[model samples]
Target: MIPFHFTGARVLRPGGLIETPVGITEGRIVDAPCGRAVDASGFLLLPGIVDPHGDGFERHLAPRRGAMLDMGDGLAMLAVELAANGITTAMLAQFWSWEGGMRGPDFARAMLEAHAAVAPLQAVDLRVQLRVESHLLDDFDAIAACVERFGVGYVVFNDHLPHRQLSEGRKPPRLTGQALKSGRSPEAHLALMQALHQRSAEVGPAVAALVARLPGVRFGSHDDDSAERRAFWRALGAGISEFPETLEAAQAAVAAGEPVIMGAPNVVRGASHAGKVSAQALIGQGLCAALASDYHYPAPRQGALKLAETMGLEAAWALVSDGPARVLGMTDRGRIEAGLRADLLLLDPETGRVGATVAGGRLAYLGPEMASRFFG
Candidate 1:
């Protein structure tokens, strides 16, 4: 690959924004000569986004109920979307749940296999994050084996069962639709949910044993609703809090030095659709560490720009890049520094649009307006 040098750009350096040339050589940013030069004047050059957790690709994998696309094709398309949005490192959050079909263990294993096969073909650094349902006690051993076989680096605990409804002996809302998607009868699904809810006591120990068996892997907790719940997850070695549902939970995570991740849509929308804690409030209070795209593919850049209205550019950008990289224990590609990976983005400062995106020293995406600058 030919070396590329970007000059006349307002680069986001460690100190602040500076007008200087950035060089890329052999996939790393370096203070070296270049084979080709691109004029990046009047553009804001920042680090490419490192999304720590996102399930936006779920739509691509299974666009409709019982209709699924090949995982490799889904992931390839996902890479383009990530590149277009200036994301270089992405953790695709795939669920291993008791929810029957796509969210079940079989689909999880299939996703891992497809990821292993297609990840090498994509420009973005695609990593797997296994989102395991806390109530899947029976699949703990198999899940652990899958993690080992796939070398999954991140694992997060999620409990989405409607405990209130289950304990009341009533079928959860939308039981028929969920059952159809899972290829199970509504009666069977209701029975399964009831069984899982009844075994909640044993599930905790089973989860603890599962975590104990998988030592040295990064773990996270989802939808923490209280300080006590956050503490419980912390004790289980889950140092990352994903989408803390309450201000207290977010505060607890922050106080304990855990990174709290909120959805980028919350920042862009100015409120959480779930009517939980506001992401902007969390950011303002220094409680939110990162803003992931969540279910939307284009929210990170737009959300950061929206947040820049209050927190300035560098601080807002950190929520999508540096903060997430730190949370994931990846110190390689989050910032624009010499010797780090050359994952960077050039944006229209005024429009807040991505003009070009370079991942691992390769120009993975280029917008039409900037076409002449590089191609001419």
Candidate 2:
């Protein structure tokens, strides 16, 4: 069946706009200005978004303070929201750790099984990208097993603790309401962090060794704070920098030919909530390569529109969609093209509210309930 054909929308394709029609078939773009039309006048059509970072594991596997929801529920809700925002592909950041609670081995297992059951049914492209915390090295074997089961696509080395330690404990600190609710004093928390820091150091070598063999999986580094840090990660075979915390780190990644991602929230908020480097600053310097929604699901789309409004249309749109897709090796979906993936987002050009989102040429998200009505 002809999947879909949207007309009258400003088509974002290679080299620019297409005042023509789009032919979507078999979940990929079959041709351009090639067929029938689905009314989309006054809308700006764009490629489906690509999001590489977001710790949804925490939200789904561990929803509240000491409360863990069904793995399926979290994934379900996330799928809707993601598709709504034109995110045709989402990399679920699976946090694996030997630590108690959220990132525990048991939780990881549940996640792996859950993904196995649902990823295939997703409306948008869904893949698992293990977010490995070196401190969680004790669970490395189990993690490897899970990756094999999930056909994992990517892995990101996250040493938040180590970076904080080097920066004198200044990074976005973690907070488990359970811990605070348990009446764990601030001193106790500090002690826990220090212990976690030590644990991270203890298993670094083993994690390094395991990561070396997963060549099929692309590797990334998280929260890079400096040029040296970027170089160090690149040396470790992690060529993508996820949310580099400083402009210098982003520049270093660019210099090394590594794609650097920034949080979409950073772009919308104009800076990091954690007081780190601003996404705007990085974008202005041409140091940004990708955009991830981070904690908020709706941020990516809104951030893209905001970035476009501020940084000119072409550049802003690239940060969230084409740019990230390019870095992730998704040559098929970033922009509208013949023989590419038919992932498109139709937006009300004025407010940028997503009017319709089609994945694989199927309209997956639309109108009121289809999108986060708050922004877009």
Candidate 3:
């Protein structure tokens, strides 16, 4: 690969934004141009986005029920999708839940194996984050074993059980469809749900044990709804609060020095689809630490530009780039700096569109108007 000397762009650096050109050599930023020169006039060059959590790849992996595509093929396309949106690093959130089919443990294991097979050839840094349903007490040992087998690093606890309705002996909506999806009868599903709910007292010990066994992986809790719940996860060393459902929960996480992650799609759409705490409102109040792509691949860039309404572009971009990198304990590639990885995004300032993306010093994605800059 030729060293890239990017000239005439406003670059984001540690000190702030500067109009000076920058150079990339051997996958790191350098002081002088060593090879080809690319005229990047009228562009904003920012750090490549680092998405800490996202389940958007689900569609690509399994476009429809029982109609799964080849993992390698799907992942290759996902790389392009992510690079087009300026994401350099991403955590593909896969679930291990009772929901079965795509979200079940068997599929989770297959996805992990597939990730290992396809990750080396992809442009983006794709990592797996196992989202384990908290009520899966029967799968604790299996989950721990898979964590070691697959070399997975990040895991988050999620509990989507309709505890309130279940406790009142009322069936949650979609129980019948959910059971069919899981290859179970509706009555069996209800029985399983009731049994799991009845064993609520044992959930804490099971979670603590599983978490203890995975010593090196980063742990988080999803959909935190209360300060007390935040405290419970904090006690278990789950330092990341993913999509806190309430302002109080977000405040509690922030107060305890935990990173609060929310969906970038929420910021772009101006409201939460689930009617939880608004991510835009959280960012405005300085409670949100980072933004994930969540269920939409294009959201981070759009969301950051929208967030620029309150905070400046530099700070807003940080929410999708540096902030997420910090949450994942990564210090190498979020920003464009000397001796750091050359992961960058070139954006057309007027339209707020990504013109090109460079991941690990390679030209990964290019817009129609950007060919001249590299080729001319």
The stretch of ten residues in a row with the least summed lDDT in candidate 3 is: 64-73
Model 1 alpha-carbon miss at residue 296, Å: 0.7
Instruction: Give all TM-scores, in the order shown.
Output: 0.97, 0.86, 0.97
Flag the better candidate by lDDT, 1 or 2. Answer: 1
lDDT by residue (tens digit), candidate 3, 221-277: 999999999999888778899999999999999998899999999999999998998
* Each prediction's whole-model lDDT (CA): 0.90, 0.75, 0.90
Q: Which stretches of candidate 2 lie above 4 Å from their native place?
A: 32-36, 56-62, 65-69, 162-204, 368-376
Ordered by lDDT, highest first, the candidates read 3, 1, 2
Overall local distance difference test of candidate 2: 0.75
Residue 344 miss distance in model 2 (angstroms): 0.6
| Candidate 3 similarity to native, TM-score | 0.97
Tens digit of lDDT per residue, candidate 2, span 1-376?
4555667778776666667777787777866544445677778878888888877546665667656456777777778878877788888887775334555556667887887888777777777788887665656777777777678878887764544653475533554553464356545655655766666445546756777756687888888889998887776678899898887888888987788899999888988999999988888888888889888868888898888767766677887788888888878778777888788888777777778788877767888633443134
Model 3 bad stretches (over 4 Å): none
Cα lDDT, model 3, residue 284 = 85
